[model samples]
Target: MIFSNHVLLRESLHAVLSTELDVTSVGGDDGEALTAAHKIRPDVIVVDLDGPGRHGLRTVRLLVAELPECAVVALTGRHTPHALRQALAAGARGFASREQPPAELVDLIRRVGRGERMIHPGTALATLAAMNNPLSARERDVLRLAARGMPSAAIAAELFLSEGTIRNYLSSVVRKLNCRNRLEAARLAEEAGWI
Candidate 1:
């Protein structure tokens, strides 16, 4: 099944896939996709990662949770490393660009339907980079607050800790990230999608 808000894109995919495979299309809306999945029980579902007004991560989460037997492949034009990570975290089994050849799309879907998993190489690198981040969860929380320009006092109040504790967290974050200051550590975490 192909799920997308853009009618023309759905039709285009349907046109291409219909020539060689069975296809069903549902609107990008979450409610409609869930309902169709229940009724149609498609072997594989293709959803647009950048669909209109449809947060692809949430959609993928819902489909994966409600239709665990179905394989989902997110199609997108954005195709950024962070976006791909979001898709994988949401439980999508496959990822493909909208610009991929029709034959490739068909093959990817088929492979995923047969219980294979796929990840873009760039996304794998992003995951590796994320693994290298040495900050603890508390340290990351401090940096996230810092990214919003919060002072130590405010972050302490928000976290229900002392100002000195917040400062300690900030210092830890900076040391772990090997940065000169808290601000630089915060910026690095934010840029890496950690915050």
Candidate 2:
């Protein structure tokens, strides 16, 4: 079963996967899907992570806690490391981008049902690159503020660090990331999923 809030996405997905022998049931909306799953006891449940704010994540957590036998897939449009991390952390066995070819979703669901973790290919790479960067806590805070287009003086004031200390941190961040300029360093940090 696939739980989606969007009527069109739910309807289209239902139409595409209804004939598949592996998919026993498909529905639109979380409440209805959960009800149907309880009634039918399907092997897996695919939920749209893009649903309401923390609702999708909370739903996944609840489902995994309540239905240990059922697997959950997080389907979303955003492939950023933050989103993927949140989904996986919330107990989604699979994460697929809505931008991916529809066929990929079927393959992901099947693979995930068999106990494999599915995520955007680049998501792992970017996440790994981010994890490998090893920025210090202060450096990371400075970089985050810099990425938001904050000036050194403002960062220093906000963080209660000396202006010179903030400048040194920015310089160190640039050197660590091997970027020639502050903007370049910020862009690299953001692209590398550091922020």
Candidate 3:
């Protein structure tokens, strides 16, 4: 099974995966993927860990707890250690990066199906660096929004908080990251995979 919200990318991934492996199902969003995962009970599930509306960690957590026999592989473009840790913490057994060749992803799926642990080296390093980060989870969230070019008002609206609170969060994030400004803080946090 495969879960992805990107229409064209999902289709392409489906095509490639189908040629090498028997894909039991494919879905566009959280609900569809969750339903298909339970109904089909596929041997392996490939989850895309991007997209603003998608919460891949939460989905993996649910699927892992429900389908212990099924292996889950998290796929991402960033190759961040924090993302890798989040995936593994949610019970994902494998991590695949977009930078790798297609053949590697196929191999990762097969290995994961056979019950193996895996992660890209870059992600591993990021995971280690993430351990040293000082910001809280909420701070990370605010910084992530800032990294996306979202102002305090917009971030506050999205997070259901006051604009002043959002600014405070950003200020704290800057201090913790040892950055001169919000942009610098966001950039450093992003590069370190803290957000």
- Scored by CA lDDT, what does every candidate get? 0.84, 0.78, 0.82
State which candidate has the highest lDDT. Answer: 1
Model 1 agreement with the true structure over 1-195: per-residue lDDT tens digits:
999988999999999998878999888479899999999999999988777886767888999999999999988875555667778889999988888889888888899999999765455566568766677788888788888899889999999999999988888888878999988887777657677
Clashing pairs in 1: none
Q: Sort by TM-score, best first: what order?
A: 2, 1, 3
Q: By TM-score, is 2 or 3 better?
A: 2
Q: On residues 1-195, what C-alpha lDDT tens digit does candidate 2 reach at each position?
A: 777766677677777767563554444445666677778776778787775443677778877877878888888876677777788888888888777666777778788888888886767676776677667888989999988899989999999999999999999998988889888988777766677
Model 2: clashing residue pairs?
A: none
RMSD of each: 4.1, 4.0, 5.7
Error at 171, model 1, angstroms: 10
lDDT (Cα, tens digit) per residue for candidate 3, span 1-195? 888776666778888888999985465567777789889989899888784566877778878988889899988887766667678888999998867677778888998888888786677877787789898989989999999999899999999999999999998888887889999998788767677
- On the 0 to 100 scale, the lDDT of residue 36 in model 2 is 75
Sorted on lDDT, highest at the top, how do the candidates line up?
1, 3, 2
